[model samples]
Target chain A: MKLSRAVVIVSTCCLLAAAARADEAPLEGQVLVLSAASTTDAVDALRAAFVKTHPQVTVDAGFAASSALAQQIAAGAPADVYLSANERWADFLDEKGLVARRRDLLSNRLVVVVADDSKLEVKRPADLEQQGIDHVALADPTSVPAGIYARQALAELGLWQDLEAKVVSAADVRQAMQLVVSGAAEAAIVYASDAATSDRVRVAVELDESLSEPIRYPVVLLNRGAERPAAVAFYDYLLSAEAADVFRRYGFLVMADDHPAADAVPVAAAQRWWGLSRDEWLALRLSFQVGLCAVVASLPVAIAAGYVLARWQSRAKWVLELVVNLPLVLPPVVTGLLLLFVFSPKGPIGGALAGTLGIEIVFTWLGAAIASAVVSFPLMVRAIRLAFQAVDPRLEMVARSLGAGRADAFFSVTLPLARSGVLAGCVLAFARSLGEFGATIMVAGNIVGETQTIPLAIFSAGNRPGFEAEVWRLASISIVLAALALVASEWLERRHATREST
Target chain B: MNRLSFRCAHRFAGGFALDAAFETDAQVTALFGPSGSGKTSILYMIAGLLRPREGAIALGKQIWLDTRRGIDTRPERRRVGFVLQDHLLFPHLSVERNLTYGLRRRRGENSAIEASRVIEVLELGDLLARYPRNLSGGEKQRVALGRSLLSGPQLLLMDEPLAALDAPLKDRVLSYLERVVEEWHVPTIYVSHNASEVRRLAERVIMLERGRVVHSGSADELLLEGYSPSGDWEA
Candidate 1:
């Protein structure tokens, strides 16, 4: 008996010693872990714990919408492990035979959120239909996972019908949260994680779990990932009790092993606002503002240059024309890089502006305006120059003969005659400004609200996406806006011509 | 003493050189020439539209152009109204606006010539609201003469203002032009190849051929002398 007892103590001590050693030794090699954006905080905590036990291992965690990660993996992205926010996306990968192994990881709650100072009150899903709430922002239910959950919840609660008119959609849960922060809407429905991240909004209502679709995230291992020992180790570590605690700590309602077996619907949800998003709306507004300001800012200079090119007799006139047209000829990226070099903080002009004038253009809306103005300046000058050329010089001479000075002749006679061309020029410049991207991104730095015009916003939003539809929507809106401007100017030109003809 | 004295020498790109000098205080002096003569060049120089290679010009001692002394005034400030062969009414402006333009720039002096009187004399009363492009050639010429008259200019320069008109229209516009200068008492330099026009419009005449003044005398004497198309005479 004494000998058996001693043997048990030695084996137990050996097991304890082995566990201690594993805690001290860092894991070896690298692992590329992809996680749903909703669980980014939880995944980061999981990575921290994994690296602590296996200090030699480096985990690179890329967080995006779960559906996006699945699509990326299907498109041959080498993801080791995917912690998705929904079973549908994981099932999508599994159907492609890209998933080597998978299990349900975590679940999340859908909550309606409102600004802290909002006078609007809502305690239940039906409360969303209350009189005080005219606009309710949510993730695009057609594609975004949170939006799908919100839609399911609203449908089950029988409030979808009444709230349809009041609903405004966003690109994702985070953007839905932004609607409340921006005060563009009275309330929003987003994932609890997104609400937890923002301090400006508070949860107005917690959706009933039974009414919504089961919000379970399934973690999957891509086929390639299963072969990597470190990837498999990281995958195992995520499923451990330690990761569960992290998920729980961050407001994820952790669930058991099974998820819904319902086939993933690849079909996007029914159209809302013809598939417009808050990001797209903001982008449109920002684009027009930038284009208009750019045109207004550069018009005087463009007019002067155009007048000289049209009327002056100089050998260097062609050279001036060529110089003005250079931006149109050069690649936009080259223009962007050159502007970046000149306007960056360490650069000469940027430094002077910051130090002396307390003015900052780099990474600001003004910088975006400057970038677009430079890009579109040639178009404006060219149009106005052609207009000026078409004017009979005799008309100006007559004005001068009538005691009108140079400035007076231009303002009174020449400019009025060139009205259609001037308007056409402004439209062209404005359209160009709307599409300006490369230079604006370099100079304005694509800050979400301030410097992000439509193009830059499209790029930034496109970066964190399964948002192909959203991006295309934005692109089409911009095209429509530009087309409307063109049509309006053309109509005005025709009207002026008809009036002249009579 | 002559109220306007101008001396200018200019060379054309086609190698035609205009070396001319003349003085006139007549209420209307016509510069008579054939199509290629330098009548227009002389008028252009006095109006400061053309820079003479070397010259001096004065209107009642105002010293309009004295290149040697670097004293050249801009055309608008010179108070000289110029009417071109094309009438040169601003196509964008109505006849009324065209007339008001120079009147507006009277610069500290209220217009001495009334707009209504000038309009009526030129028969532009019917066309006041019409754009220059909308006016007939004769109507345009009427508006042009009226516009110049309203400016209250010290001198009026007309370069074939009746050249584009038919015989009857020319006679009508010529009558208006005559009345404007007589009424305003403005020193006028009228350019034309038509000897009859010179005789009817001018108190004195200077005939030019091949960029040189071939004759100058009273309108009847110059017309009687005739513009020698072959440049046979000297000033």
Candidate 2:
């Protein structure tokens, strides 16, 4: 009896042990790292090293301008780490108590880069004053750290006053580099780290460090709940000797100190009165007005086409489907170019419109919205078609059987069931319209308030000098809006699905 | 004088097809068949919901569909009604709105049917304001029927209207259908498979097997011969 009791006690002990093991299973920690758009390489290099040391942890990294990253972190992203290109963001995080430790772990140098085979003669800072230079790319001095440094260098060289008119603000330093590489701009100011990552652009000159404020990157450990240990581990690993080598290899100078100054600028909260400048607000409101117009404008055509696709069973369906999906498949820039080629003042459609109707689409907000709508129209049709498909054809048939004509049956039955899908499609189209950048920028030049939407504002702000805080503010607002939109769509879809099943 | 009579043929992609030529002087004539034998297509052809490759359909004095003369009437102007296999009631609109849609379509139509008479005939007096979502399967079909009838159509095309209901519900709805046919006296093309239902509801039967009409005879004659169109019939 004692032996049997001992055996039972042992079994119970094993069960308890197994339960304890389950309870003590290794914790899951996700570490988010936000890096400036141009510093993607540096951030990636640092993350790779840190992750090597902590293989159990998952890292979520986003690359945007330092200003945009700061804005996103400020807007309550569950980030565990923020690595900004300059001290401004670290200081902002320090003020909010979001940063575990404000440390200036790295320094970056600013340089002007040009495409390798460019004809533009840009040898020195003063050479930028030369005539015939149509476009010069830079991060907006207001928000991006690299752009701020570039502006300081230009100011020190007395080039800022002369270069203002020729400048085109990009959303981030990386995009600025792209402008130079794509031959869209004559030259762009980017980080030495950024220049090292691309082979298409050649460094024109490294500006004297003394001409600008010292480029310091502050590394902060975010206080994300339930992930504190992993966050701190990743943070500690960043300051380790091995990670410092990676930073140095990537053309960044590791700073001895990592502390945010008490007098650093406030991490600006998202500005909500549509959270845009007068020009940006106008663009946003116009985007809405135009998006609604575009959707309404395309409604008849889309409805007719959608019906043909869904119900007609015509032999020409394949051709129509291809046309409908063409805008989606083509690159935005290509779509913009196609529009430009057709709508340029001298182009065929443009010539007709301008010559006959006294209307033009060149560099116009209407044009931008049209381009946006055309590119996004497929999404609307697809959503609407799905809604129509969900509706039972029998309903219409029943109406006909009751002495209702075909038109009567359609009005009574098929349209109602497709309501939810149509609404969803409209929302999707509207969002796509608001966020459209490339096609809008190409088709409608970044004319402030006239064509500059929030995305364009954020881009230009990132490129503009002394507009960093504003860029952060706008980015934060956009992120919040986008998140809200996603949540709403998800909730709406779930409710509809539940109703359909029940 | 006969108010509604028609003959039509329908062709689809591939060779799978249906051809029918019939005339009905009575209130109801059923085109009975198994599933997917082109019964619905025939109803669609009659209501002008579908166009035929080569056929003629005339309702009273109106030439609805004639391929040779290139005279095809739109479904909205055909003035013929239809009821489908499943009750296709609008979930968004109330029963009253569903009934009024047809009235709105016929705004200039002088002989438009009365809404009150339809409500009374279909026994939907209490359910006029409710939505299709708030209705039973049988109730929805009744509203669908009332809405169609209120459009002032010359004829009705019903494609297995009670196929979705339970046996008890079908019986209850069938009796209401009988009242509609008798009181309205509108010519109807009723499609069904239930032999008993066809016998009770229709005066004549045009039986289709595969895609061709196998028999066209009085309901009693077809029942006695077991609906075989094999002897001395021209190919």
Q: Which candidate is the best by DockQ?
A: 1
Tens digits of lDDT, candidate 2, B1-235: 3555556666678777777776767678888777777787888888766777788988768787788899987667776667776666666677898787666666365553578888887889999888777888899889878877877777778889888888899888899889988777778889987776777788888887776687877787785565333221111
Candidate of highest TM-score: 1
**Residue ranges of candidate 2 with Cα displaced over 4 Å:** A1-293, A393-413, A464-467, A490-502, B1-6, B107-113, B226-235
Overall lDDT per candidate, in order of appearance:
0.75, 0.70
**After superposition, candidate 1 runs with Cα above 4 Å error:** A1-275, A460-465, A489-502, B13-16, B109-111, B226-235
RMSD of each: 21.7, 20.1
Error of 2 at A382 (Å): 1.9
Docking model 2 quality class = incorrect
What TM-score does each prediction get for chain A alone?
A: 0.49, 0.52
lDDT per residue for candidate 1 within A288-391, as digits (tens), equals: 66776788778779999999999998888899988899999898878877876776556787778768876657655667888999999998998888888877
lDDT: which candidate is best? 1
Q: Estimate each model's TM-score.
A: 0.63, 0.61
Please report how far candidate 2 places residue A78 from its true position, in Å. Answer: 45
Worst 10 residues of 1 chain B by lDDT: B226-235
Clashes of 1: 4
